[model samples]
Every structure is written in structure tokens, then in C-alpha cells.
Target: MLEQVANGKLTKWLAPSMRVGWSMVETVLLTAAAVGIGLWLRPEDPMTLDADFRWILLVPLVIAMRYGGLVGVWAMLCLIGCWYVLKTSGLYAQQSFPEGAMLGGLVFTLVAGEFSDLWRVRLMRADSAASYSLERLKNLTQRFVLLRLSHDRLEENLLTKPYTVRDALFRLRSLALEESSDTALPAGDDLLGILAEYCQLQRAALYPCRDGVIDDRPVAVLGENRPLEKDNSLLAYAMENQLLAHVQQEKEESYHGAYLVAAPISNSAGKIIGVLVVERMPFLSVNFENLQLLSVLLNFYADVVYAGKDTHLLLERWSALPFQMARELVALGRLREEGKVETSLTLFVADDSEQAGLILDALARGLRSLDLAWWVSDRTLLIMMPMTGVSGLEGYVLRTEQWLQDEFAFMSLRQAGVRFFYRHMDTRSTEVQLAELLEAGGV
Candidate 1:
């Protein structure tokens, strides 16, 4: 919705008034172009209107079809009226036609042109409104399906401690891999399962679209039907650039059929998460509404994944965190990638009480942002040190421990096992070190 077109002098001068004001200008310009072309085709004296002028009549027809449906007809009428008035007064002498036939042709042509434009406007509006309504309906259905899946997941949690969404996804990957390892299907994805359940596809195969070729590697059967890898893959380009590619139907082959429709699963802010492909029986095509429905459904699938991650579990607390924190976190992520700065991993622990919450928040405010990660357990809070490795962590640990002993030594947390932990995370997790710290603090 927010687009910045960078070039063109005419574009620049008209940009501010373009959307609303430009439509009328377009109508006028089109009319002028049509009339000018019409005059070229049938140049006549001001006094004459000829039946041979039929070729030029097409000019008005083209204009009416392009813009200003009813308005175009009215303008043409005004042009004819001016001509007739100019001729009748002897200010101009009208040329001969088979006189009555000329009058008859003029009447017939004017009425037909008037209604032709009206008919076009009606058809276009109807087509547009109908398509829009169908699109909205399709989206609603897809969201309904996604919400239903969310509800099913929630229901499972009622009777037992449910896995987090990330765990569920990992489990799904394992299951998919196991099932498809023997079969000619692709592994490590939950997409096909969702597609099978909803769209009732016979079997959906996810093909790797590299460059301009399709690589069909169903279920870890890599290079099964090898398509040449292009220097740049088409799918990758579409994804990185935020665009869509036309669906390609498959010819008779040993591969699963064409992805009848494909869309990039995008986050709420419209970043591509992954691609969703829906395949179906050969020779079948989806209507506009159904296609829109599929689009909405796939997007909803992406939303639910995010919901299961942070939203579903920590709605209240997450909501309470200022939006600024989220923005800063994203900035930290970008900075960390460039590898310019260093950070130290630290932990914050407090009794599960209001006072502890306040201190943890204050600590959050004081800490420098980095491309970092953090975790909050029942009593302990953890922050990731993307800035530093093991060597930098030792001094930070000692100073931080002493600082905590002085800072909150008066509060219940001091006696209540308030502690901090610093662990150097190499290529592996610092889980064991965290456990030792937690145990030492009797947490």
C-alpha cells in the first residue's frame, strides 16, 4: 500500500493529486485523444457532417469504453449539438447526405453510443463488486479453518501439559520425515498434511523451483528427477522480492502435478515466511473466489504459527511490553548479524512475586540492546549474550554477582534465593551451567 516510485518528471509534478484528481484528468485526456484521432480519420468542414464519418465514430466508442462512460456519451452529444447549431444558422452550410437518412443515422448513432457506454459501466462495476465479495468470502473460510486448528490444539492442552508450538512443529517434521522417508514424498514440513486435510488433494508434492526449472524431490528423494539448478532460483527470487509467480501445470510425467496455486506465507507486516502450495487433480482450475480463499487460508496458517509461539502463551505479559521494546529487539537482531558489537549473557532470577517483576523490568530497561534472546522461567529470567563468548563471560559473572548482592540484598529476593547466572555459550547450549547456578541458589 505504501509505494514510492522514484523517477519521471511528469510523475513527480502530478504525484500529490494523482489518485483522486487524476481520474478526471484521465477522462478528459482520453476524450481529447479520441476526438483528435476521430478528426484525423474524418476531417470535415465545420458546416458538414457526413455518414462517411462512421470510422471516426469508433473513436468515441474507444474513449467511452476506456473512461467516463456516461460522461463520454454526454460530451459527444454536446459536440454534435454544437455542430448542428453552428450549421443551422447559415454561419455554416451543412453538407448533403441523403438528407432524411442523414438525420436518421445521426439519431440512431447518438442513442446507441449513449447506451453503449452506460452498458459498459454497468458490466464493469458488477464484475468488480462480485469479485471482491467472493475474495472476502474465501478469506473468511480460510481463517475459519486456521482457527479451528488452533481450537483443536487448545483442547488437547486441557487434559495434559501441551507442547509449545515450536515443539509441535518439530514433532510434525519428525512424523512427516518418517512417513515420507519410504514414500516418494518430501519430508520436514507440515504443509502437505494441512493441504490434504483441507483441500483434499490426492497427495501434494512440494517441488523445489530453482532458476526456471522444477525439482521434484518428494519426501527426501533429492535429485530423483533432477532439474538443473539455475544460478538464481525463480522461487527464491519471488520470495526475496515479495512477488508471485504464475502457476505452471505439469505435463504427463513421474512427478506430482503442478502446484495449482502457490503463495508466500507472510506475517502480518507482509514479510514472506514460506511458500504454501496447493496441488490438485490434473486439468482442474480454481475460480477467483476459491483462489482467494486459499490465499486467506495459507496466510492464516502462518498467523497461527506465530500465535502459538508468543501470543497464545504470553498474551497479557507480551501485550504489556512496550512496542518500543519489540522495535529495539529487531534493531538488535540486525546489529548482531553484522558482528560489530559484543555482548555478555546474563540471567536474572527473583521470587515469583510483584517486586521481582518490577526489578526484572528495571533490568530490562538498563541493559544494552543486542541481537539477543531471552527466556523467562517460573522464577528465573535469562538474557542471551550474542556479543561475547566464554572468555568475556568470566569477569561479567563475578561483577554481576557482587552487584546483585549489594543491589537487592535488602529485599526478600536476597534471602529468597535471588541469583544471577552467566554462562558462555559456545556452539552448544549453556544449559548445564544454568542448572548449577539455579541449584546453588536453591531455585
Candidate 2:
């Protein structure tokens, strides 16, 4: 499956070169065919200028429509070359060139090319936005599943387990921050221990993956487990789909696998950095709820593993802020630096603390799944929006204003004693910008 993915990527990488080559070939052949037809009709004027309509201009127009302006210009040059060929070969021809006709054709081709280019860019941007949205949706779906499962389990095991899932995650974050080892999976044994307690895995192993390839050796193992197999079906399925796969998922296919469950551990950017394979677990524990918890826990651990050193420093500086928010802020900043996407941070502040608190509660209730909100103080609130640009921020602000008017009967934000400030993530250091924003909001 990995090999197939790699091949598909390679094909996509070479598609542009193949497209250009094919376009060149088509331009040459079509130009030749058009010249042949023109010569058959009027050998004296192969360009067919003697006719009321210039039929030869269609070649460049077609090429322009198909391959854009550059290739269309190439087709026009080929026509010029054909004309010169006729003139030099002593075929009957006019003394002067048809400059007006050629100029008109060039202008028409360029106009068509410009339209194509414009639509191409629009389509590319739309596709990129869709892909980012899809990834966000997938992440949110996993979180929702985990939430539902956690709630159900809490009802059953509230007395048995002293700490909630959130507490376990906080401990995981602490482990990530404090680990000094250079291995890819920091506090591997502790992570597995948490999973064992939560997922009821009697025997499992966590194997580190580098560059999409899983290592044969296990970084962390619980109880007695077989060594990692090179051709494990569950591992292949999990890596292929970037999700959790278990024996019950496809009984006919996965029943033959040596492990009961396999899951990929992916970072916030959705890159798999590790794999967890369970060799032994109770039959009742192989259900969807338990598997979902396992996947979520692995993903949570992966996020902590991927958080850079900058995130740790930010956490140390602002102990009140959540680790997840700090990690996302740094990730968005890196994305902005790479010119892949933009993020926005909005601060809502009010002179009246009571009004601000009310507004903050309302905003909290209306927050999107992808947004992270922090109640910075009694008089201030901060929201971080991922993959949002200036235009998106404007729309968000407008919507919030309308909601305020409808919910609180306030004429405007100013009337409600509220003011908003926004900043788009830029090339500056994320930690520095965050500190500045927080200080400006008087946090």
C-alpha cells in the first residue's frame, strides 16, 4: 500500500512535464494538418487569406483554449514558419504580410489564455481550501467520537478511575515536555502504560515510524508480545487508510492477522509518526468504543510528540494557556511562514467586566470546532481561528455582531461596551506575537 501511494505521488509529480510534452506534440500536428487543408483549398494562398474567412487562425485559437497563451503563441509561430516556407519555396504569395490579421489572432488567443489562467488559479485555491477543510473535518470527527465514548465510559467507570481523560492528556503533555531522551517516541513506556490502563490492552507494542516506514523494533511494549512482523495485515491497513484497523473491521481479511488491533499515531498535521499494535486484549475490549479511545489516545500522544521546542517555551512563559492552544499557534505560524495558509487571532475586550463576561460566555457557546478560545481575563477573551484569512475574519466578526444584536438586544458592540482587535499570523515569531497580543489585551 505504501509503495502504491509513493507511485501515485510520483505520477502526480511528473504530470506537468508529461502535459507540456503532449501539448507541444498536439500543437505541431494540428498546425501541420491545418496547413495541409489550407494548401489543398488554395495552394496560392495556403494561409487562406484569399477566402472571406481566415480558417488557419482556428489552429492557434484551439491551442490557446486547450493549453493557454504560451502554447497558443507557439502555434502562431509555427503558422508564421509555414508561411515563410511557402514564400521561400516560390509558391505564389502576396508581397506584404497580413499584419492586421496576425495581430488580431494573437490578441484573441491571449485573451482566451488569460481567462484560462484566471480560472485555473481560482480552481487551485478552491481545491486547496477543500482539502484543508476535509482534514479539519476528519480531526473533528475523531474528537467527537472520542468525546462520546469517553462520556459513556465515565458513566460506567467514574468510581473506578480517579482521573478523567483530560487529566490523562495533561499528564501526557507533561511527559512530552519533560522527556530528555532523543528517541522519536518520548516516554514511550509511559504512553503505553496510559493506553493500557484506558484501553485494557494486556499485550501491545508501540513501534516508531520514520518517513512513513515502520521500524521492526518496538519502542515500548506491555507484557509479552511477538516481534513486529514485516507483512502484518492490520499494520498495512492502518497505514494505508491512516486510521485504526482491528480484527472485527474486516473479519474475513483481518482475522488472519497476528494482532488484534493496529493504529497509526499521527501528529496535528496528520502525518503518521508511530504505530500501535495490540497482540492480546480481551475479546469484549475489541469493540468500537475501546478502539476509538485507543486511536484518540495515540493521536493525542502524537500531537505532544510533534510540538516543537518553541511550544514548550511558550507553555513555560504562559502557564495559564492550554498546551493544545500553544501547539496550534506555533503550527499556524509555521504554516504562515511557508506561505501555505494564514491564521487569525481575535481579541474581544470590554471596559465593563460583567459585560465582557457575558459576551465571552455567548462566544464560547458559538465557537466553531476548529477555533480555540481562551478566557484571558474577566474583561477580555481571545479566539484563535485556523486556516482563516483576513476575509474570513471579517465575516466572523460580522456574524458575531449580528448574533450579539439578536441575543442581547444590543445595537452594536460599542453600545455593549465591547471592542474587538484582530491580527493575522505573519512572518514574526509566534511566541513573541502571542505575548504581544496577550499583553495588549491586558492579560
Candidate 3:
């Protein structure tokens, strides 16, 4: 079996390389042999056989056609020299060297061979362009097919019940956020039940976490008569790698023969908090998409734990949310109008990357405690200052630009060159104007 596998790989490797080399070799050798035979067939005496053997030139013509003009020129020189030697020795025919025929053959070889080479080059370029276009078309088609399948799945799931991927995620987020008011996660058993139903698993178990290590005892068990062992390698492997594991059942005697999947639940800090073991029900094949969705939901549960059950502080630091920014903007506008405080909002739209993040970090450190910033898009950030005006905004922007230039020499944050866009909101503006500015992203 090993030898067969090795031979198969060797054949695959040789197939493409051998094709061009073998064809060139075969054409060169075949044409040379034909030329030799033609010379031998010529009569010894000039009386019986014709001295003009124009048919012999066919060998060089073919070489010029298959190879190129340069190769044809070289072959012509060799053939002409051989013909001269044969004729002078009276081996070919009783005649002197045919200089006119030789010259004609040389011209023919050069012209025909170069023309063929030029045509072949053009053909190859055209083929390469076509292959590139075909590959792009295939990629587009595959994306379209995947999108169609996703849409169909969404519709089918929604028609069957109100619970869909969106609802499952929203419920998970709500549960995570609820940690602020409570110490122990409320309804841990119910949450496990929700997960089991969402993933359509027949039997499952959930473990509680203490000080980063998952408790061996099951905190919640669903649709199972007896609890499974927590020390299994399948669960241990998933927790160690921080990934979902699907144990393939090889036979009834195998270790994971009864279970289908083992997954870990981790917090934002990547500390394993729980393990979810599930059994595959008949006729229901688990898929990658479902596994990913389950993993995200579990991670959110972990995030809740990491937040120390405090929803407010978690929400404040994670200001990349539009609604959060909008709420703060409304409060700032009201405070400005009431003559209680002076505040400004700056909209920064820069390319999304690690470098842009550095700019954000610098701003975060330099700004006051009341200042706020959030990513409105993958490439845009909105910053709100509780007590800053237009002049203060100008200084902040310039300082940040200087910092960016100093840190990354290749990148200059000049007004014209940089993709970053920023504008300070007018605190004197009316509520309607504030709303308009927020809606239009300061235009």
C-alpha cells in the first residue's frame, strides 16, 4: 500500500514536466532521422536519379514549424554541412553543392520557425488570461451558492419556530449582561437547556468553573438518565485547545462511541469555564456552522463571567457600539443646552488596522476621564469629550497626528494624505441640528 501511494505521487509530479520535454525530444529526433533517410535514398549516379532533392528540405521545414526559427536555423546549418560532405564524396549524387537551394532552405527555416514561436507565445498568453477569468468566475459562483444556502436555512428554521440564530444570540447576550445584578449565574440549568435545544443535541452536560479550572462535577445535565464522566480526554482536549471537538465513532468498543461532540466554554480572558458534552441523535448530522454558532454563544457566557456580572462597566469600555455612542451624544447635548457643561464630539474615520488601534490607544491615554470613543465601523471611530471645545479638538488631532508620524515612519497623518476624517460637533447647535449631525455622521 505504501509503495502504491509513493508511485501515485511520483506519477502526478512527473506528468506535467515530462509532457513538454518529451514532445520536443521526439520532434527533433524524428526530423533528423527523416533528413538522414532522404539523403540515403538519393541515386549514386546523376543519370538515373534527380540531383535536385528539394523533398529533403521538408525535414528542416517541419523542425521550423514545431520548434522555432532559431532551432530551424541551427538544424539547417547541420543538414547543409552533411549534404555538402555527401555530395563532394559522390555518396549522394554526381553534383556540386546547390548554394541556391541551401540559401532558400535557410530562409524558409528562419521565417517558418520564428513565426510558429510567435504564434505559440500569443496562444499561451491568451490561455493564461482565460484561466484567470475562469477562476474568478468560479469563486463568485461558489459565494453565490453559499449565500443562497444560508438564506434557505434561515427561512426554514424561522418557519418551523420563532427561535432562530438571531434570537438565540440575543438571549445569550441578555443572559450575559444580566450578570451585573447577580453573583451566581441565574438559571444555569435553564441556560443549558436552551443550548441543548438550540443545538438539537439528545444528551448533554455542563460544568461550572472555579478559578479558571472547570469543575469535574456536572452543574447542569439535559436529556440524560445518567451523568457522564468529566475526566474524559475528549472534554480535556477541547478545553486545552479552546476549540470544539467532534469525536468520530469508529466502533461500539471505542472510547467516544457513545458521544458525538465535546466543546469548551471560555471567558474573554480565554480561561476555560465549562465543558459541554453532547450525543448525536439519529438522522441529524451536525455541521460546522452550527458548531461555530454554539461556540460564540458559549464565549459570550464566558464574557459575562469575566465582566464580574457588572453590565454597566463592560458596556462602557466596549463603546464601539452605535447605540451606546448615540445615547452618550444625547446626554452631552442636553447637558450643554442646560448650561451645566461644555462638551464636544469628534468623529474619526481611519483605516482599520493595528496602527489605527495605536492611534486610539494614544488618544485614550491623553484624553480626560469623561472622554469616550467607540468604533462606528470597521474603519471609523467616534469620540466624545464631556468638556472640550473646537480649539481643544484641534490640539488633540494634531498631537495624535504627530504621534502617528513618529511611531510609523512609513505613514504620515497629514490632512490630505491620511484617510482619517475628524470633525468637532458645535455644542451651541440645537437638538435638531445635533440629531442631524449624528444621523449624517457630521457629513
Candidate 4:
């Protein structure tokens, strides 16, 4: 608040009236000094130097260039006024060709002031255009840099094959769409199909595992329904090391003779969640390209699994999800205890349910990507913003209020019953409260 107050004072000092007043005062004082010097240097007879005071005219010219035409004109007028009073008081002798000498000084003042004003106007226009262009260039450069970085990240993560065809691009797009559309983790059938289509593997088996333990039979298989034996060392080695293992013909165990490749499906945290086994060909047939593609696809699959979604509606409204609220709070509490991140929650209440959707749409435009908004009730919205505190939440509320006013100038949204409340959740303390809310309904 103190800083803001100081800034306000600085702004007021820079206003036009303050600047012009100071400039005019300086001009007036200097012009009076020039007139006094002329009087001091005056001869007993002014006819000795008919235009002796002509040199003093430079003072007004200099002031005109420094403070602009208006100040310059006033300074010139004051100089002329002082000369008229001196001549009337009979302190300085009258000059011959007085009209011609005075006319020259008057013309000089008008010309200097006019040129000064012209230059000032031109300079202002040039500065404005330069500033506008520089701002546009800066914005474009930032957007371009962000676009390039996003493209580079996609390339590094996906590692598209060299000389990739249009078909490969289409396949990648299809996978992205499927990954976004499906709420749950990719099923075993989906993995098997990707292996066959992209990795050129015709035989494979998917074994489901939970927390690094394979507790169930094969969930999916291709080309054969035979389940992997429990004693298979190849499968055990892949799961134990959390890596892809290739069986050599000379070193292959008798029980695993038919299988050539075994890979583990790990989650984002590097936990072994499932195991994949394929035996369509020998180890030499599986190139590094195939392995890389497989790894990329599995990593994407792991992300979808970790996202914790069930249905499309739940995914769309994941912020205020009743089922996930307790889990999210638990994770937030752990992070806070570990001194990792900050979190804040904001609630927007609408007195009129009919305008809730409109308010939500406008609010979304003002929120960051990490911020999530969901409707907990018909007239209430809960927004969870990661890495934000109470002060940041206040700024967000003010920005949203301003945006609503700008977008809906015809209607007063704030006066129509939209209200917002925010609190910085002490994640450690709010965990139990969040759990209770989840058990009842979303907060």
C-alpha cells in the first residue's frame, strides 16, 4: 500500500499541468534576467547602438526550443514588455529605425517558436510509431519462441521415425486423439494392436501387475492363448530389472525358449505396473527403432493411467470431482509437509443459476492452464489453482471481474449476483476437511 501511494504521487507529478507550469516558470525567470542585463549594459545615449538589445532575443529563442512554442511566446512577450516600460521611464534613449529593429526581433521569435513546435510534434509521432512497432515485435518474438519450444518438446518425446511418411503422422494423430478421448488407462487390447500395427509384432502377451506384483493371469494375448509360465526367468528378469529383456538362442532357458522379447510396462513414477511379452521373431529382428516406438507408446499409456479418470464427464469436470477430491487433498497435504508446492482454492457463487454457464466460460478465459474450474453445484463453482496463494487469488478475482465488465458491458454481471470467495488452504490442515467434504459432497 505504501508503494502504491508513492507511485500515485509520482504519477501526479508527471501530469501535463505540473510539467508545463515548471517549464513556464523557468522561461519567465530567464527572460527577466535577459531584460535586466540589457538595462545594465545600456549606454547614456541609445542612439550609439540603435539595436543594442538585439542580442537579448536569443534568450527567448533558446527557451522556445527547450520548453516549446507557448512558453517561448510568453518569454518573448515579457522581454518586449520590459523594453516598453524602460523606454517610457526614459532610462534608455529612444532608437532611430525603432520599428524595423523591433519587427526583426518579433519575426525571429515567431519563426523560432513555430519551428520548435513542428519539431516537437514530429518527434512525438516518431516515438509513438517506434514504440508501437517494438511492442508488436516483442509479442511476436515471445509467441514464436513458445511455439518453437512446444514443437521441440513434441519431437523429443515422440521421436518420430526418420523419413516419416504421411501415414505415420496420421497414426500419431489417431493415438493422440485416443489418448485424450479415453479417460481410463489404455487396455491390453489397445497395447496389442499398437504393437502389431507399429512395432510389426504378431505375437504378444500382456500380464497385469499391481505395485510390482503380477497377481493375475494374462489379460490379453495375440496369436496364442498360452499364458506365461511362473518359472520363466526371462519374464522374471524383465519385471525385476524394470527393463526390456531379449532372449539369446544360445543362452535361452528351456521354459522360455519360445519367447524372444519381454518388456515391463512401468508407470510415471517408474513403478512396474504391467509386463509385456512378445515372441514373433528373434532378438536380432527387433531394432532400436521398434524399441523406441514401443517405449514412447507405453510411456503415454502410463500417463493416461496416472491421470485418474473414469468417464468422459468425469474427465471434463475433473476439478470438482467428488471421487478424486480426497485423493487430491491427500497428495496436496503430502506435498505441503514436504515443503514442495503451494495450493489455493477459490469458490464462485452465483445467485442466479441461469447465468452460471456464462460466468464459467468467461472465468475460464482468465485462468491459467494449471488452474482447474468445475461446477460443484448448479450455482457454485470450485477452482483449484496450484502454486498460488491468497494474494494471487485476489488478483485473479479482480481480473475476472474486470473481464466480465468488458465482455458484457450491456449487463452488470457483478450486480446480478456473481460473487467470489478465496482462501489459501493450509494443505496439511485441510486434508481432513477435504476428505469429509468428499465423503459428503464437493466443497
Candidate 5:
């Protein structure tokens, strides 16, 4: 209650008032000084000498400057009137009132007038600086937000979807549609495929050979709807040196066509995952903003390859997750398949009806209810453990055995189907390797 009362008082004390609390304070102090000085300076003509009240004149000026501009003017006029009354009443022996009044007015005009001018300038400067800073902050925020959205879309295309020629072509075609003014020039085979389709490079097969020449071996070439030129040495050179090059630069002179460009793909860890390229003619017309967007999109492409952000969705559809989940059940019924991390997936087919309820009761010991990323395929549950390593797969499998023990005590958990397969992460080995390990242990 006391605090509330104090706040109310503070609200009433808003400054810049002519007859406010501070002005009253100045008035009292000045009046007292004038009275005291009059007696001290000339006691014989005390009223007459102080009648002008030269010192007291400053009180109203100070109040006006600090509070209201119009109040200061009114105060000067009042002081002059007071001096005349003192003189006319014969309280002052002064011959005329104008002399004292003039002195008081001069003092106010010089002191208070100068201060208000200086204060206005200072306030204006401060306001300008604040406005500039706010504008800059807003612009920066806008750029960051745009970049984030671009990254999201990039991950959706690169990491989540299966790499197919037709899929990639669709993306490139979409970009052309968006930038309607750009020429629909023929897209170079490799770069065009990824650009119009996947927002990546078409050069998946080009790699460095033993003799330092670029070789097209080990590339994932789409048959018939080829995305790369067969004998182009320049394309090979660019991919071999990890060089940034245009897909069109390698095109035959007779055709005189170039619409794609590609760079070697790198993962989040900066290791080359594969070559990433884009195909689009009239690309030179793209502005700085658009180019920045492309760079961001490509970086996310690398993330998909290395991070396995959406790999779970595909595996679930296959009814066989990429191995970190349900390791025990998947490990059964396979003799040749190694219970590995990256090379294979371990599936634990969970039953939805009777089997699910039974499994939940049996494995109710320590297994957490909040499983992060999981997939059900062929009635099997596949878990992607990004932290699991090959060595840890066995332990994860053991955990599975315990879960299975609740229902089929004699189901010899080791008799489940466990198969390991290697995913081609192109050149992004470390990230791919790490992903593989994570999927193995469901970490």
C-alpha cells in the first residue's frame, strides 16, 4: 500500500510546468534572498533599493525555462508590475520603477534564453542517432529470417528425399518458373538435373582418378535422361580439383549452350560429400540477394547428406529403418548380415494390436516413453539413433532382447531379421560415418 502511494506521487511530479513544485521552490528561495539582501545592502532605503528585486527576477525565469516557455514571459511581466507597485506606493524612494524592472528583465533574457536554445539542439541530435540504430537492427533481422526459411526448404529437398533424376529435374523447372524472365535455354545434363530438380549439381559420377584425370566411374548416372556429358574433360577437371565451375563452360562449342554450374558437395563438417552443381542459363542476371539464397540452399544440401535429417521418413516407408531402432528384433533370422551400424538397419517389428500392448508391458522396465525419431514399417519399428556407433550396436540389441523377453520368452531374440547396408554419402564421409554410427545405437 505504501509503495502504491509513492508511485502515485511520482506520477504527479512530471516536470516542465510553470507553477509546479520546483517553480514554487525557486520562488520561495528568491523571495527570501531579496528580502534579506535589501536589509543588508541599504537599510535606509531598503524597500526602494530591493523594490526592483533584481535578484528575485531570476526565479520566474528559471521556472519558465525548466517548465513552460510561455510561463517565463508571463513571469517577466509580473516582476515588472511588482516593481511599479512598490515604487508607486512610496515603499521605495526610487524615482521611477522602469530602471529596476529593466535590470530584472535583462538578467532573465541573457541566462534562461541561452539555455533553452542549447537544450533543443541536444535533444534533436539524440533522436536522430536512435532512429538510425533501430532501422539497421530491423534490416539485419529481416535477412536472418529469410536465410532461416531458405535453409528449411533446402533440407527438405536434399536430405529428406530420395535422389532420383526425375525428382531433380522437377526442382530446376520450378526455379525457372519462379524467375519467369530467365531464358528457358537447354539445361546442361548434370547441373541442370539438380538445379531444375533438387537444387544441387548433376555431377554425381565425376571423381579424381589415379592419373589425376577426372573419371566418371562410381557416379550415380541416370540412364537415358543423362545429366552429364560423356567425354567432357573440363567437367572432370573441375570436379577433380574441387574447383568451382560452370556446367556450361564444359559444353561443346557447336551447341554453344550452358545453363548449369556445380561445386563439390561438402557436409556440415566441411568434408566433400559429393559434387553439387546447378544448371541455369541467364544466371548472371541474378542479383546479390538471389545468389546469397542459392549459397544458403546448397549448404543445406550438404546437411541432408551428412546429418540424415529426414532419412527416417524414407526408411519407415521401406518398413526397414536405417538401423538404430529396434536392433534386437531386426538382428534375428539373418546369417550373412552383419549386425553393423551404417552398413545395415535393425528392425523390431512392433505389433499394434495384441503385440503392442504385450511388448509395452514386458519392456516397461527402463525404456523411455519419449522416443525421439521412430518409424513403423512392415509392422516393424525402426529407430534412427544418430549417436550410436558400430561397437554399441550389440548393447542396443541387448536392450531389445530385454524388451522382447516380456512376451515371447523362448522367441530366441537372436533369431530376428537384422541386415546392415551402406548408404552412399558421396564424399561427406565423416558426417555420413557419424550418422551411420548414430543410427546403429539409436543415440
Candidate 6:
């Protein structure tokens, strides 16, 4: 068995490397065969120089089409080596090199190689896009399933439960915000309790994790607490894949272990900072919808934890700023600092006039779903567009102007008594920039 495994591993490793090896081998063998045919047809000029066509050029052309530019160049070098061998061996006494023929062959080989490379790059890009889309589809499918389940539960318990999930989430957010800084997880027990109520858990534990290591001690427990197993298969799988794993999953059948559910608590940036391990739950709750809901709730809590540190201060300073906008601003600031993404902030201030208010209202309604908008005042609106660069901001302004022209017959925003200010999120402090923007807008 060990021998078989070793061979399997070796095969996997060599599979990708073998393509280049085969290309080299084919280049050598085919070059030799072409030279052999030339020698057989014309012993004096083995390269078939006197022929109407230098057939040896086909070798590099074929290799270029099969492999790429570098390997094709190697094939041309092989042909040159064969020519040197013939000349040095006294079989051919040609002093002048066939530079013209060689150059033309190289040009054709490069053209073919370039064509191959272009398509290869396009194929790779297409595959990457498809993979990203598929991942998004999977996430949306899970959320949809959870939403349907939550809707059904809401209808069934409309009388008993006076609040919807949205209200519960808002309350949870408030609870998380009110948590003291000393604790690793803000409102840990409350979070677990809420999860138990929704996910129907009898026994579960929330374990704080850092840098992919799960702590043995539970931050919160629903029932009798138990030590986390260091080598739990479900935990390992969930952590490795950054996904929720449960007994019902097809891949978990072989090694379900002592836990019924294992889910990673990932922040907005998809970093796992904690793990949720459920030991006892209703058998029916082990299904997909409940598990998905559990995962979603954990993710929501994780996002709150991730953004709470920065947003807390912002919220304290700006009482009127929406919590969601504050969170997104903090996230965008971090992203800008890391040089991972760029975001734009557009502020629209309207004069205290009826027409300006109408234009501002129209602009508010026209904002994209990805954009976060906040009305700093009755006539002042702040919009944050994520992943939009300076050029995107310019385009957005032009589009908005054009839209105003068509919709309200206004030639320009200024003509409509609307003033706009734009700023790109840079490495500077977000709070300082936000203050500067608010001050500029006379807030």
C-alpha cells in the first residue's frame, strides 16, 4: 500500500512537469528525423538546401504550435546544432550561414507561439471568472435556502415570536456594540443563546480562534461544557475549507466524529476568527436549511466583531451616521490601507430650495445597490462607492449629470443648484478624512 501511495504521489507531481519534458524530447527526436530524411534524400546537403522548400523548418513550426515560444526557440536551436554538426564533420563545406531561412522560420514559429499564448491567457482568464461566478452562486444558493427556511419559521411563529429575524439581527448588533473590549467575543453567551433559539441547539460551544488555531476553552456554552477535541475531523474540515461541515454532508459520513456540526466564524473579509461546534441538537435540525442559518448567523456576528472596533468610535462621534455605512467605511478604509482596493466618496449638497431637494432625492434613488448612501442633513447626502477608483468617480459624475439632463431637463448639476464633492479613500486616517468631508460640507 505504501508503495502504491508513493507511486500515486510521484505520478501527481510529475504530471505537470512531464509536458515540458515531452516537448523537449519531441523537439530533439523530430529534428533528428527531419535531418535523417534530408540526408537520405540528399547526402551532400542534409538540410535539403537545394530543394524548392526547406522542409526542416516544419520541425520548429510544429513545435511552436504544440508548445510555446520558448520551447519553439529551443527547437530552432536544435536545427542549428544539426547544421553545425554537418559542417564540422566535413559532410558539407558551406561557410555562409542560412540566416535568411533561419530568420524566416523563427518569425513563423514566433507567430504561431504568440497565437497559442494569447488563447492560453484568454482560457485562463475565462476559467478564473467562471470559478469566481460559481463560488458566488454557491454562496447565494445557501443564503436563499436559509431565507426560505427563515420565512417559513416566521410564518409559523408569527404569533409567538413578536420580532422578525431583521429585528433580532439589529438587537444582536446593538448587543455586540455594547460589549466590553476585554472579552474576545462581545456578548458571546448572548450570541450563542440566540443561535440556539433559532438553530434549535441543546448543547453547543463557541470557541475563540486566532491565526487558524481553535482555543480549547469555550467562550460560551449552551449546556454542559466539554473540552474541544484537538483532532476532531469535522473541525479540521470546516477550518480547512472555511465552510460549515455537519453530519448530513456527504463528505462527513466517513468521519463525523463526536460533533453534529462544525462551522467557522468568518469576518467580512472571510477570515476565520472562531469556530462553532455543536455536540447536541435536534436530529431534524441537522438538515441543510438549519445548518445554513446557523452558518449565516455566525458570519453576521463575525462581521460585527470585525467592524466593531473601528465603527464604535465613529458612531460615538457621529450620532447620525448609519451603523451600516460606518461599518462599510471602516472596511473600505482598511482595504485602502492594505492597497487591496480603492473606494470613492461622493458628497452631494443641495441648496435650501425645493428644486435642489427634488434633485437630491432623485440622486438618492439613482444610487447603485452596492453604494452606501447617508443623508448627513436634509440637503446634504454622502455616498460611498466601493471598489471605485478616481476614473470611476469621474464617470459616475458625468453619468449623473447626463441623467439629470435627461430626467429633469437640467444641463448641469450646478444649474440645478446642486454641488458635488469627490474624494478617494487613501492611506490617510478614515476618521480624519470623514471629518474633513463633513467640515467641507458645513455639517
Give the number of the best model, judged by lDDT.
6
Per-residue lDDT tens digits of candidate 2, residues 87-155?
788773545677888888899889877776676667579979989999999999999999999999777
| Clash count per candidate | 8, 0, 4, 0, 43, 0
TM-scores of the candidates are 0.24, 0.41, 0.39, 0.38, 0.28, 0.41
In the range 107-158, model 4's lDDT, one tens digit per residue, is 7777877887787678579969989999999999999999999989657535
Better of 3 and 4 by lDDT: 4
TM-score of candidate 1 to 2 decimals:
0.24
- Window of ten residues with lowest summed lDDT in model 2: 9-18
How would you encode candidate 1's per-residue C-alpha lDDT over 213-329 as one tens digit per residue?
444443321112233222324344446554433344222344343344445555333545455444443233244323433444444344333332223223343443333223322
The Cα error of candidate 6 at residue 400, in Å, is 21
Candidate 5: 10-residue stretch with minimal lDDT: 331-340
Clashing pairs in 1: 185-218, 185-219, 186-218, 186-219, 211-233, 342-387, 343-387, 343-388
lDDT, ranked from best to worst: 6, 2, 4, 3, 1, 5
TM-score ranking from best to worst? 6, 2, 3, 4, 5, 1
Tens digits of lDDT, candidate 3, 137-234: 99999999999999998886544333554566446544533434243344567677677667666677777766657666777777763456556666
What lDDT does the true structure give each of the candidates?
0.45, 0.77, 0.59, 0.60, 0.43, 0.78
Q: What is the lDDT for 172 in model 6? A: 57
What lDDT is reached at residue 420 by model 2? Answer: 76
TM-score of 4: 0.38
Residue pairs in steric clash, candidate 2? none
- Select the stronger candidate by TM-score from 1 and 2: 2
- Residue-wise lDDT of candidate 6 within 242-311, one digit each (tens)? 8888876636447747788888987655677789888998776676556655765676677556665567
TM-score-better candidate, 4 vs 5: 4
Reference-based TM-score, model 6: 0.41
